[model samples]
Target: MASGKHRDNIKQQSKAAAKKSGNSIASRISNSFRNHQQVAVDSLDRLLASISGTLMIWIMIAIAMALPLFLLLFLQNLQQFGSDLDEASQISVFMNTTTEMPRLEQLRDELLGRSEIQNVEIISAETALQEFQASSGFGDILSGLDENPLPPVLLVTPLAQDAAVLQPLLASLQDYPEVDEVQFDLDWLQRLYGILNLAQRLTYMIGLLLALGVALVVGNTIKLAIENRRDEIVVVKLVGGTDAYVSRPFLYTGLWYGAGGGLIACVLILLAQLILQGPVSRLAGLYEGEFALVGLGISGFFMVLLLSAMLGWFGAWLSVLRHLRAIEPG
Candidate 1:
């Protein structure tokens, strides 16, 4: 009976030890989670504690971000306009005035055979002269002439409107023996495309500059916050707090600033789009176009918000890492 009792005590002790170990681990995990939650809460409190100051910084960041975002939206709309213009682009081929009717028919057939030409249309000299007379009010003066002075023309529509493709095709048509001239307003289209590309590059340059400005803004704000809490940081260090522990709250502070600024920037962009929509729509109508302004969709919105927060976090981390080393327990 004594031996049995001894075994019972040993088992009880073993069970108690297991339970205690389990409880210890669980408690540690709970505390770790709680500390993390506390850090976030404290960071939010810090932001709220100085509303006016935080807002000023946020507004600055928003303005910086909005400029680049607006430019990007404008470029996207321009690309749509370019696409519409591409569809309307056409090439005009004027035949030699004295070319035979059979050769003209042959030229038309050759153009139709090429894969690059989408459509071919013939404009005889008689039809052309009649059109000129009807519009120019020179009917009686032109009738006195023995024959029509105008040349037959071919209207060639290409499969592509891009200058590179059209240029080569136009050159090929000009090489035909029956062809007199090939004329296309490709220079105007090329110039428009060049301007659009320049604008896009400029927008990128501006965005990069403004992003740097945002980082500096956040960094300066974090530095001030750190300065304000210098004594608190020193005390924590003296009490055996790890560097990571001391920096966690400040890091959160930066994140709050970045996220808040990004949200404001998005609001500004949306408001701009809303206010300009009617005006833009009317302008498109004036040109007989169905153009509509496009805003950053779901993915884009979240990307802006998340990117802002990341920049803020990065700025804050940089500031903390730089300034914390200077702070030590005396």
Candidate 2:
């Protein structure tokens, strides 16, 4: 009888212990959820506590991001113009007025036979005179002249529009005795492309510097936050809070800072684009160009936000890791 009673008592204790364990697990989960929620609320409160200072930092970050973005957009537009110019590449070779007709014919045949020359159009002096008269609306002024002042010319298109190929061909053509002058219409295109390349490098350098600046800003802010909550951290440590628990709030704070700055930067970029769109469109129209100003579409918008958030998170993590170890229960 005693043995049976003892077995029953053990079973009862086992059931009670199981229930206690379950309650403990439930309590822990509830506490964790509450802590997370509180951390988020505190971070938001911190942001709201210093609205003016936060705005100033956000604006500084926005300007830093905007300058590079503007330069990149300018480079894009310049590249478009260079692409158009390249497709229409042509060299004008003007013959000496005294060059014989047979020599001119020989030169044209030679250019046509070369593999580098894609197409050639020969414009006679008389034909050029007639075109000028028709296009210039100066028929009356030209009718008084007895002789056409224009020289015979050849408009030559190359198989390659690159400077490497065209430059050599231009030099070779100038060596010809019948050639008076060779007008390279694409020199400015090369120059503009070179400038764009330099500008792209400058933009990259500037972006790197600004990214470092952002990291520094976030780190410093997180460090100050740590200092402000020093006693609370010490108390939490005394009560057996883990390092992860102590660091969560600061990490959230960094994320908030980064996200806010990214949003402001995007706003600045869009505003600048809006202000410049009309002028850019008008300028393109003047050149008969099919060009339009572009902005950070959906992909770019997400990218900016994601990058900023990562920077903020990393900065906060660094600060927390370095400083959390210094705070102890003692």
TM-scores for every candidate against the unseen true structure: 0.72, 0.65
lDDT of each: 0.87, 0.84
Clashing pairs in 1: none
Q: Score candidate 1 by TM-score against the native.
A: 0.72
Across 124-238, the per-residue lDDT of candidate 2 in tens digits comes to 8888889999999998889899877789998898887667777799999999988999998777787877788888999989988888788788888889989999999999888
Best by TM-score: 1
Deviation from native of the Cα of residue 217 in model 2, angstroms: 1.1
Q: lDDT score, residue 139, model 1?
A: 93
How many clashes would you count in candidate 2?
0
Q: Please report the candidate that would top lDDT against the real structure.
A: 1
Q: Which segments of candidate 1 are over 4 A away from where they belong?
A: 1-38, 94-166, 238-242
